[model samples]
Target: MKTVVITGAASGMGLSATKLFLAKGWKVMMADFNQEAGKKTADELATRYSKKQVAFHKTNVADSSSVKELKNATAKFFGVADSIINNAGIFTKGALHEVSEENWDRIMAVDVKSIYLMTKYFVPDMIKQKAGTIVNTASISGLTGDYNMAAYNAAKGAVVNLVRAMA
Candidate 1:
């Protein structure tokens, strides 16, 4: 069976993707920053499927060490991943000049750096196997300038280009 590793698997698009994959009979490692929510989602999926089909590991995708731990846990539980969904990201809203440095950093770390971290640890194994897919979620904001989401637009734009370059 194919196995997928998804960051931000506790909610939103990530959660929806998890359900779809499980329904298709794929094993999934759900990595999310919120431990309680991640575990709860995994538990519910586990019941609907099987315990072995779902696993949750609390992860801070912005941090290299945390991402490495997530990679290791996935390897231990489900072997090499066939796909990685870099779905963990944050949104920030402000005028270009009004965006604080801290908020800019936070948005970049979660939305852009997390993709780099995930790829750093997972891509080599994918190469070794001669197969794998990496999906980085981006928004329409990445395609056009927005009034109040400068940081979000910039970060997501980076992700769009990064994925294209990777391809």
Candidate 2:
């Protein structure tokens, strides 16, 4: 079975995608910041599928160290991921004046920089194997400005450009 790694796998798009991949018979490594939720989801999947088909790794996608550890653990568990879904993200709703520096930085780090970090650690394995795919989840707000969500718009806009550049 192909191995897939998904970040923010605890909920929303990430969670939905995880279920879809598992249903398709792919081995999945569910990575998320919420240890409890991540483990819970993994346990449920294990019960439905085989325990061997699912695993959870707690990760802070924005942190280089955490992401590196995720890479190491995933490699140990299932070898290099055949596909990586860089889907971890946060949304902040506010105009520029109302947005804090901390919020802006947080959103940018998680939504934008995580892609670079994931690719940095995972792409080499893909290159060695001569195959791989990277799917980046960007918001429609990234393509056009959204009301009262300046930081989100900015960060996701960067995501769009980054994906374009990667392509």
Candidate 3:
């Protein structure tokens, strides 16, 4: 069966995507920083689908070693991924001047650098395999600016352009 690694799989669209992929007969590796949510959701999904087809890994997508561990988990569970969904992101709402440097960095790390890190760690295998797909979950905010959402806008905007560059 085909396989997918979906970041942020603990909730929201990421969770939806995981269910959809599984229903479509794909093995899914659910990656999220929320260990409790991730494990619980994975266990629930396992009851509905084959347990072997779903695995959860606590991940800090912005960290290199954590991403490396994710890569290892992917290979250990499902081999080289057929697809990767870069859906993990965090939003900090504030005007640029009001946003804290820490908040800005967190947003950028999760929304932007995670994709870069995932690509850095995962793309080589995809390239060697000669067939793979990457789906980045960039928002409408990535396309248009939002009031009082400068950091998210900037971060997501970078995601939009980064996907374009990858394409």
TM-scores of the candidates are 0.98, 0.98, 0.98
In model 1, the Cα lDDT at residue 70 comes to 96
Residue 110, model 1, lDDT = 97
All candidates: CA RMSD (Å) = 0.6, 0.7, 0.6
lDDT of 3 by residue, 105-165 (tens): 9999999999999999899999999999999989999999899999999999999999989
Q: Write the per-residue lDDT of candidate 2 for residues 91-111, one digit (tens) a residue.
A: 998999999889989999999
Candidate 3: which stretches are off by over 4 Å? none
lDDT measured at residue 124 in model 2 versus the true structure, 0 to 100: 95
State each candidate's clash count: 0, 0, 0
Task: Give residue 126's error in model 2 in angstroms.
Answer: 0.3
Total residue pair clashes for candidate 2: 0
Candidate 2 regions exceeding 4 Å error are none
